[model samples]
Target: MNVFPRLPDNLTGGLRRPNQVRRDQLEGAVREALSRQVAVTRPLTADPAGQAIRRANRIRRRRAGVGIALGVVTTVLIGAGMTHLSGGSDQQGPPIVVIGDPDLSAQPLATASVAPPPPPPPPSSKASADALFASALIDADGKRLALPGVGPAELAHRLPNGTGLLVVGAPTAAGRSLWVAQDDGLVQVLLAGAGQIVLAPDATQVAWRDGEDLLVAGVVGTQLIGTVRIAVPDSAQPVRFVGSSLLVRPDPTRPGHVLWRPGADKLTEVPEQDTLNVYGSLPDGRLVSQVSANSADGTCLALVDPLRATKAARTACGTRLSPDGVGGMSDDGRWLLVNGKVGSTDRSLLVDLERLGTTLDAVPVGPAVSGAVAWTSDSDVAYVDSSGWLVRLNVKRVRAGEPAEQTPVAGIEPGDRPVLVSGS
Candidate 1:
């Protein structure tokens, strides 16, 4: 389309030669912009987005690809008065824009700022189209622990000291069920339709929802002894354990989160925490959850005080908080690993709960918020990246505000979701 209508003979009559020269210069500028823009948009390596088109080509079948969005550039060629343009969004660097027509020769091509290729897929963090989980769980030392349990075995969260585990899988004699594992054996339990089962911080107690009943039992050796079943309110489910007390939700239709003490006959609503969803708890009586839905600040990680419901919380919507009650919190209740957004892409956020404002590193998590992640220690975390390699990193540097690398430990197999055996 013609951006500028042809200047009439009357307008160019007095300056035909100069106008002819100007039109030629503009034509040259448009050609140059088109070439540079093409180079920027070309899929040289041909990746997909979620970081999908970017990730579908990653080490494995990760929905959201590892974040190489650090170099996204948007170039538009409208007309002559305005020409070359590029730069990324929200961030300071790429995806820049040029408004209003200006001198073409005096300006440089923004496309000159091409981004370097994504660091060669993090060495060992590559997976295949068919890759799944490893045969068994992996420990901090990178050793695979294949359970003696027959058929399919998916470890949910490792028990205290990696002594036992909670396994879930396809239908068995136990029906669509949950199992308790120790050594090489598997004992099926109820909670037929449930999610990550949680244990007490001390590991002396275990909790789960069996039908409408919330069962609190003693973890003795491989068996659950002295089981006490407290029928929860209709539709309520057990989420995480704090001290000897269990945090239950009276179904999603309910307003506040419920905390049922060991022998309590009823659910106690945690004051001021009515809007929070408890995912982790601290020995000091604090709780972990996402920001309240009623909040105008948008979603991020938040802490709830069980004792005194008020505190000057730090909030940042730029990066989100991802983990739930599963293997989300650390042994000491200080560091947390969750899925969050780094700019416009999905990434894992290794957050130092004690320092929420500063150490929320927007690290790349292969599976956007899906897949499996387990914590091996307060300073170390393990997970199978999008590439299907089990990686362990010293979270010490990350918590202390330093750089931490996901050191590749072992390659993961297709259909095998690996978890840190000694899940803290």
Candidate 2:
């Protein structure tokens, strides 16, 4: 029956009697909310709230260690400003070197590499006529005059300043003497005879022929000066120094026409009619005579201006020769060397008085051409060839028409008579 019926309000109230007033009203509302949170808390003190919470956790770990030491000093100032703006600071400094002057820089590159020294060798007229017969005091038998007691020295004259040697020597007892031979050893003699020995185009004077006397000597430095003696006409003939005067022929018995100029006393004749002699004087004082309009007409070679008694040029008519023909004038009178005969064959020309008659510049010289014919202080013509050989003919290469050269003078020996000493 109790399982079946429900209790009323008073019944239920009684059952709750054991609630102690609802557990004392829930323990007094949990001690009144823990006394209202212990009346707003406030009671801790280890020393002042435990050093104020250990100084607020050591100032939050010293402000997080000053923000991690200012983010590790701004990553070490951005890696030292990116290693100084990337040039890496010129790897950091110091090193360099240079020097030169080894004694002003040496030299000898072959004397600045070479090139300038080759032009001076053309004057050998057979070595100046073998050095004028090797300084001639004349002794290879007076240079072939065949000396012994001295009679045939025959080279009547020569001294185009190669010093001297005027031998007409015949001293077997001093008969036809005039033997000068001086290269400074002085010999002199003088008592002359068979004519022609005139040297003195400034070779300091020396004219000869002492038979009819016509002396005129003056040479200083080897001594022999002033000797004047002039008594001509015993048929006088050989004597020529023309130009400061003395070109005689007073009257070699007459055919030599007449040409005397010996002033200071008298003899001045100059007719020269068919004049057949006078070979050479020109260095402008002119007088290269050998004229003739008769004996069947031939020889004329003139140029006579014996002080303007005029005839300044001749030589055209027949170009003849042989009044004993043998010409020679070239101590710069330009050149003449004749020696004619042509028909019985003796011929030896070379003319060219600067082209004399417009075209016969001549230059034949063949018929074996022997003995006397010499010039070469570059006028070149030297001869001697009957196979004895000395030879040489150039004549400015035959006046430039070319074919003349010839040249064969090695030791000279066609009996050795080469006389050309005119190097002026």
Candidate 3:
């Protein structure tokens, strides 16, 4: 009986039926080939001469089979735009066939074999772009079905687009620890280190300060793949991420004020302006700031891209920039909430930083609204009130001539566990 039925010519890749027996057969074939390599590298020389000869013959036959199987697998992989095996290995063990390199001069060959035809050219960027919408689908049990070897509990955060980045921390022999995660849940380790990590919007890499020099690490499959250090001043604050781009703020006393470093390739600077206090860079390349110089009657909010002011305007009405305090920007760059001052009293203002730099409304959260002001990607802001209540303030309705209402979003007291609010 035929142990294996031939797969149909019409059965395209990635279209195989679930739990298909052929898939297991293919995996076993590859495993057998790998086992042969291991056996050759660890030869059993203590066996009887007859047994040793038999083992050697078996190794030779298996090696030949592996060479042939490898060629077919390589062809299939190349056609699918997957990774190609590296050309060489540094170990002194018996050789294995690799796809790209033609000159097999390192090891003696028992026999020659035909190389499969090369794969076709890659698809156009437009087509490739459409096909690259990677996503992870999680079941009700909080388990991600598509990502291998990861549970929902392990995920630190999921991007708006659904790609998840997981971090696993383990202690070293000496007592220190390291954490690593796969970048975009692919084979790349996004970060593996002892320092703090900040993932960019693209989720491919991160910017971290190892010590004095700021280093950017590429992620590959729950590991820190590689790192490149960027030149930064000693006085420069620790690294921050603005969509995978590094935002380096040079010392205020230094010649240049704000330096934006995108990966290892470029370092851009915003000319030192007397009025601008470089707060930080937004993912869309805008700066979330309050005006310090020039036309400084009220707080100044500006949109800067590539270190240039794309749009500059002052906020209106109750939204006056507080001299002693500041706040946050919405995820979409649509709003900037400033803890402004109304006369001698300090208040919070929800500034509509999108259409116009106008104060949408102002809410009196009292003076105790000091710590970190939380903006939940929407127009709402949350802060811990003095009465020990986590209050959410929302600019519910703002009409042309109507006063903006300051209503309690949801009050969380000591008893009820405050639900974590995030995302748009």
Candidate 4:
């Protein structure tokens, strides 16, 4: 029978009978010792008291050394474990915590850590594609081109030149859309949802109202720039830009337009008109609009400066305002064209503004309110007749003895009325 010293799983070996073999060997050694009469006696102590004291001291010293060694080992193990947990090794771990996260379980970010790990950076304030929410043509070179319909209502206001901007209307279920064009036939949309589009007198900026908020987006010469929400307290807001100033009209009743410089903070008020709704201003310092009273035709076709009310900015060449006429100012701020059937007369009047006080011939475009009209940047007026023909009227020709009453000066076939969209 093999009797073996059983070992725990921590010690790995095969079974054997070392215990029995050791007992037999010990018995043999004892018998041999007895036979030889080997005395194993204790030697007499010369000083028993001193020996006992020395033995006790040795035992105490051993115990103290063991305690000290145990403490040192424990401290070493704890330090190693902490180093491993703190990313002290070359191994990778989980993501680090950030300031905005709700979870507090993650470890705090280290300020002087040598590791490359750090929190992600915050969002930047630079211009992004998402900032441009919507755009509609505030003014086009020619035509009203209202998004909901396809007639003169669609044409912006025709000018003596072929360039103009279409007034983009409010957004509906169908969507807010406006098309503006110049002689180059380039069309741009200023707003896409619901709102009213208006251009500044300088033709460099466009402003609109979305709900109760006012938004300005426009181009300075060729560079696009604007503010999203310019805070104002009232509704029926009206805005315009003249030179370097921005004017805002924010009252519902007895309202007046406020003017301010773009990069400055001061504001001033524009003079009030008796009945005309102010549409916009011109660079040459003229305000354009339609008459307030439906029955009064004189003021209906009048263009007067708010700064100087006595002097009419524009008036019919020889006759007063036509009863059933529609008009708009040229881009150069020197002419006004009224299109409508006047007092049973079928001729439209193209009035040269400079000749309002002189005897200038009124160009008679056969007595008919055709499509919408707008002036181009180059000073040509474009209109569409009932036949849907695009007519381009030359201001120089009308002034240089070409006769103001020429209806279809030069036009395209009566087919597709291209939607016109202009930059504010």
Instruction: List model 4 lDDT by residue over 1-424, tens digit each.
Output: 7599666443456544344457788999989989777566656659788899999999999999999999999999988875554422222222121121111113321222223332212223522111111121122333222221111224242222324333343446644444343222223343444355556544556565556555565443212354544555656555445555555655646434565554444445555444234434456666654443334344444454555436455543334444433555666666667654456566556665555543334566433445345566456666544554445557777556564333322223345443333222
Whole-model Cα lDDT per candidate? Answer: 0.52, 0.51, 0.44, 0.46
Task: Give lDDT: candidate 2, residue 227.
Answer: 60
Per-candidate TM equals 0.55, 0.26, 0.44, 0.44
Put down candidate 2 lDDT per residue, 1-424, tens digits, no spaces. 5777666564464344444467788999999999999889586654787888999999999999999999999999998875643222121211110111111113211111112212212324322222223311222122312111234443444545665555444234434445444442223343333355555655566666656666665655334455655677676755457776777766654545334444366566554555667767767666776676654446656666665554436554345555653556667787877766656666666676655661234556554454345555537655554453445556666556554434444444445443323323
Model 2 alpha-carbon drift over 4 Å, by segment = 1-132, 135-197, 200-215, 218-221, 227-245, 248-258, 261-263, 279-289, 294-297, 300-319, 322-338, 341-409, 412-424
Candidate 4 Cα misplacement greater than 4 A, ranges: 1-171, 174-190, 200-203, 220-224, 228-241, 245-268, 275-284, 288-303, 306-326, 345-347, 358-362, 366-379, 396-417, 420-424
Model 1 misplacement above 4 A: 1-134, 154-196, 253-255, 273-276, 293-297, 307-318, 323-327, 357-373, 396-412
List, residue by residue over 1-424, the lDDT tens digit for candidate 1: 9999786674554554444557788999999999898878555474444466455466553433333332232222233213322111112222221111111123321322223222212112322101112355565556554432223644455555554565554445543444454422223342344433555655567666555667776655444555666777677777668776787777665545778887678777766554445657766777766654444434555566755657424443455544333336677787766765566665556666776662234454334433355565666666655544555556756545655455444555665555544444
Q: Which candidate number has the best lDDT?
A: 1
Q: Tell me the lDDT of candidate 4.
A: 0.46
Number of backbone clashes in candidate 2: 0
